[model samples]
Target: LHQFDPQDVNYNMPSVLQVSGPLDVKRVEDVFCQLIARHATLRTRFELIDSEPMQWIEDTVPFAVEYTKVQAAGTTADTDQDTTTDTYTRVNIEAQQLVSRFVRPFDLQAAPLLRVGLVDLGVQEVEQEAQHLLMLDMHHIVSDGVSLEVLTDEFVRLYDGEELAPLRIQYKDYAVWQQSEAHQEWMQRQEAYWLNTFQGELPVLDLSTDFARPAVQSTAGDTIEFALGREVSERLKELAAQTGATLYMVLLAAYTTLLHKYTGQEDIVVGTPIAGRPHAELESLVGVFINTLAMRNYPSSDKSFLD
Candidate 1:
């Protein structure tokens, strides 16, 4: 056995989860610096997240994150979450590139915060407003959607002047634990389900593209999204009631059926993004807890979307 390699393979990419109202750039910068100091993982850089063969910019001090000056510009949003807008361009060149280029590069943390421009609303919205932008050029190794929760929470705790607690463990250990308990039960059930359902058939898909040979493994790299309005959405939900299944499960079934019709496959395997939130303590930490599972669809002869 080759014991020379420290065991970690997955890496996280820098992502801007959301855009907030404009804030004091200085304060926002302070918050990030403090967060990094506390979370050594954030401070320490690997050419990747694990002890990978890469460069990690351990210190990002003297970092100045730019903030747009929003005037609020006399706008009212119906939802409390929504803020009025007067637009201007914001850019985080390096930060943006980091997400797209999921590989190593020089000066990783350049342009750390992806920008969402600001507006002026005079005293109504801009006053006493420490509108801040939370910028994290987190390496994929250290930040995943689930672990991000942890990172954000710790940041808030430290900012609020609370004594920050150390993490129960590191990201590396979690990866090892994940592979250990392989939940063979789930695997066996899924395998049996597929083997019986499509013993003599193929996957069902009506995809117009290269269904015979997909161009890429990850559709995330190129997923074209569409929105459904409330009326159609409600209609689908109502129809989904017949299966006594969730809207998501029902939708996947329908999609699988369509794919089978198109591809002439009786059994289907779908790639699904699952949030690996198995642990409660890791909730507030920012790391990669996102795992992908191939969902097997073994549809019987009778079920339809409406059914």
Candidate 2:
């Protein structure tokens, strides 16, 4: 009980990759999957063990990694032989795969969360051309925004022969512990606090999202992503350090300020995903231990983005 640092969890979304280069795609994929399967949480699902969602782990999945490889319309170049593939891509819609519903495991499985598709770049003959493509798709449930970075780093380390350390806990334990930690008292307090803060605010943002969809349409919305560069991100970290506040607080403040300016509302409420993991054991597991809630902030004309 001296110190317990748990891993963060993420929502269930299909995380995808499009790799184009003059390389040995199959071998690269094989190595990638092998690295992921070594982690325990990636092999687990969630179960309510003792009134909490814990990692309901299995010995292994039938196919630890699901490979979806599609051949391109050209001669395949040898993979691992890095050739430039700096190309813009177009989007095509297809039916979402059922694997989406499977509880996403972390990279610690007997095999990585593997899916492969051979992309058809359709590049017909050219000079300065030695290009091939390999695409890997992973369910985002196992890959949090931060965990993406971790996965990349770990992948590189594995390829570079860096020795890996064994993780102490899996996602299954985290699931159960989370529920236990969120006892009636905590929920009551959280409800009271959130209720007071958000009760009187108007809606924020101009995204115009809908909470409901027709019965046939499963999901109601999509997402847009943008990142803050090092300079701004570091400034935020500095502010948080000085004020002894969390990044969550700062982000909430920024959203509030943005809303007040955009909506001309003094009080604004916005919803964000919160980690539902409360117990120490839950820190390491993967599952849907997240929820959305509205936050309220006051109106201010001069509130800067960083304020």
Best by lDDT: 1
lDDT of 1 at 213: 53
* Displacement of the residue 25 alpha carbon in candidate 2, Å: 4.3
Tens digits of lDDT, candidate 1, 70-182? 33323244524333222111223333443344323324343231222222222333333333233444455456666566666765666566877666765555655655647
TM-score (all chains, Cα) for each model? 0.55, 0.54
Prediction RMSDs, each to the true structure: 8.8, 9.5
Give candidate 1 misplaced runs (Cα > 4 Å).
1-22, 47-135, 148-223, 238-242, 300-307
Worst 10 residues of 1 by lDDT: 82-91
User: What number of backbone clashes does candidate 2 have, counting pairs of residues 3 or more apart or in separate chains?
Assistant: 26
For model 2, the superposed segments whose C-alpha errors exceed 4 Å read 1-12, 16-26, 32-36, 45-56, 64-114, 118-134, 140-143, 181-188, 199-255, 273-293, 300-307
